[model samples]
Target: MVEVRPLPSADSPLVEAVDLAKHFDVSPPWLTRVLERQPRTLLKAVDGVSFAVPRGRTFSLVGESGCGKSTVARLAVGLYTPTAGRLVFDGTDLAGLNSRAAMAPVRRRLQMIFQDPFASLNPRWRVRDIVAEPIRAHGLLSETRAIDRRVGELLELVRLTAADGQKYPHEFSGGQRQRISIARALASNPEFLVCDEPTSALDVSVQAQILNLMKDLQRELGLTYLFISHDLAVVYHISDYVGVMYLGRLVEWGEARSLFRKPQHPYTRMLLDAIPDLEMTGRRRIPVRGEVPSPMNPPSGCHFYPRCPFANERCRAEVPLSITLPHGGEVRCHAVEEGRLTEAAVRQALGRGASAP
Candidate 1:
């Protein structure tokens, strides 16, 4: 069994990811590359990304698809080793796990709620087996009766009927299947959950149901979450803090309210502007220009420079260092770092005064 130490203090970051990176060798085989007289190519899925999520808090990574949010999620839960940097979970170094077998213990403490409930659940398995797999793997219960009781409790915890466990996964709806997945993740009594776009596939009403269930579970279980989503509206509703990743780097990260109120990174502002507000009375929205560049050969200097309206010669020639905010978190943008954007300039671009920049 995993021995989880009492969280050091309420103020400490529950998960601290620093300069985490993953570079995939997407090139042809070594012999093929050699025969073609071409060097192997590297795809930078996550390059120097960093952020922190506190206990019982939700920190979401939001961006366009293929912006490495899922890659970061995989790295956090010990599914993939980072090419560089660290992922410290509740003060323990996650990079030190020697093998996949050794990672079993950590797996119980940190569970992943994967995307596509239909694809994630085994169609051949009964709901009881699906939810009980984690408990049985960890040897949390020795007796069959005890395991069955635990499975029933988990199903009820996620608002499913205990009797539902007797049915096959094919017998359930997409939302019900997702509830089963949640029960499976919670069977190990995990403190952290890395949710990878869990509701993107569901209907609008079902999305709200799943998100509410997650929130209720978090409050009851004191769970820390790393929610990855391209849905800015959903991210804003569920996240306490938000990180915007571009190409492979974290361009901005801070309190969700603060970042949304005052987006320091141009890329972040662009994303927010794209979300149409039904209730935002007089807010002017800025349209995003150009497509996200290919990661195999991203633009140099600054990844956002190509499309940033505020980009200057310096922004085009050198990458901007992070600009520390007085409240918390930081932004990686040349205009924010150099104090170049006037209040009027920002108002002109975003059509509003920020509450944080």
Candidate 2:
């Protein structure tokens, strides 16, 4: 029988991941590989990542495309299992719950809000049925009338009217369709929501509206979020904690304000520098150089060494372990660990003494 652990205290994190790794074996067939004298290939999507989501707070994973932020989202909601390490939700270990029946209880408390609302929702189904599917599946409501009532409530919660439930998903705008998607995800009354680039598909104005709606919902329902995005501006607006990812590994993570104000890792600084300085602060921006390396055959030692300006012999020969920062959070970088890339040095390099926004 699957173990039913005791519930976590209020202080405990809602979700925790320890040394999580997911490797995809993207190898050719055995005969083909043998003929080609090639070794098996493994795509290390999420390599040794660790983070925790506090109850009723937002933790965002920000990175370039193919950096495994979405993979982490999938891992959290059990869409994909990890090849190594553990995923703990509340007090229960997800790795131990192998069977669907065993996972049912935990599944109800956590849900995923996928990207591209246009594709996520069924076109043939009306908005009411789309929103009601989770409620019925989870046995939250039995009677048709009760399900309909609950569906209306959910739609209303996401700023849609009850009358709109009768309309099809094709009838709504992109933002409106996303709102319906949110309503459906909430139908299960989940405590934790894994939002994988939920606003990436919408316009800037619409993204703000959706983000505000999500924030309001979180406040009203005490929900915890695992938000995934490539947009730093979006992350800044929504996240309490921020984790910066690269080549399937977290380079730095900490309180959002602190990390944004003073990014420790060179990769993190590079990403932040890419954002346009709307305020025209004249802080010299570091131009991003080179494309992301292939994950299949990652560089030795530090994956970022090839592109990093401060990389030394040590950086090319040995992987940097995560170092705890004085303010808060952790960074995996030889430069930061060895004091070669201090905040003052970074500021000086930028040709400005003022703090980073």
Candidate 3:
């Protein structure tokens, strides 16, 4: 049997997502639906997902595209209201804050660094204006000189010269544009940052630089982060805790080292197996087979069962509950719960009939 550990108390987490869910109405218009005799269709973007990020830590959600990682980011930042569940930031219930005015204080403490730096920055505006916009909006300083000085400091913090602020975003490289985005996110002096694939668009070397910068900033400012990404390598490099999602639900989550060292869920193991070997030797690669099921008409029970080699009748009939592991991680998999699968078994399966990458 898998060992289990107690989770942190509810009041302890700086940001907590409790059974969060978001469903989009993708059905045709009323007239079209009636004419076709079609029922309403709902896209399960995020379904019953929950996690907690302690202060001054990075909690990263990683999975393939369309796994609802981005939707969870939007939900945490209040861009999308939950169709079910709630988000509590520093003990404040976000759903209770109905209006913009009411959410202002919370907004000031939380900000987002969007995925596309090129599109996120205004092409028409100078970097100074872009960085200072948040400062001005938050009413941090009314004096023009003070705002300008703050903008310059932010640029310098991101390792860009103050003079670069005079130029437009189009003039800068991808890495620099992302740095400017980071500076803008910092302008409001936010305590928590929601970074949605912030470095995915940059070159490998540039990605390293940005990751280092983020780490330094987190250390200096004592910031908390909800980092969303599809790259396991990046997640391993930066995250304190990691959550693996599939079809809008988290299949496994735990400390980064623990999860990577011994992933409990079949989906998590499959994702790790997809990573290429560095030496390009004839290493046996465990194939993660099958295409993802459509969220609109997702299979009943476990979402990952179709792709999982060890899946049985129970996996196809009953959804597994989150099981806490000895290392304080959580996994949602029947194979693990029933003791049919373990870390040793995973290693053995990967070795048996593993194909070369």
lDDT tens digits, residue span 1-357, model 1: 335656534488889898899999999998988899989899999999888888888999999977899999999998899999999987777898777786777777999998899999999999999999999999889899999999999999999999999999989888988999999999999889999999999999999999999999988778899999999999999999999999998999999999889888888878887888789675666679899999999988998898988899998899777778877879998898778777778766655556533
Candidate 2 residues lying further than 4 Å off, grouped into runs, are: 1-10, 343-357
What candidate 3 gets wrong by more than 4 Å, as runs, is 1-11, 279-282, 343-357
Q: Give the Cα error of residue 297 in candidate 3, in Å.
A: 1.3
The regions of model 1 sitting more than 4 angstroms off are: 1-9, 280-284, 348-357
Per-residue alpha-carbon lDDT of candidate 3 for residues 188-304, written as tens digits (9 for 90 to 100): 888889999999999999999999999999887777899999989999999999999999999999999999998889899889878987778866676789888888888889999
Q: Rank the candidates by lDDT, best first.
A: 2, 3, 1
Estimate the TM-score of every prediction. Answer: 0.94, 0.94, 0.94
lDDT of 1 at 90: 70
Clashing pairs in 3: 3-326
lDDT of 2 by residue, 104-146 (tens): 9899989989889999999999999999998888887799998
| Local distance difference test scores for all models | 0.89, 0.91, 0.90
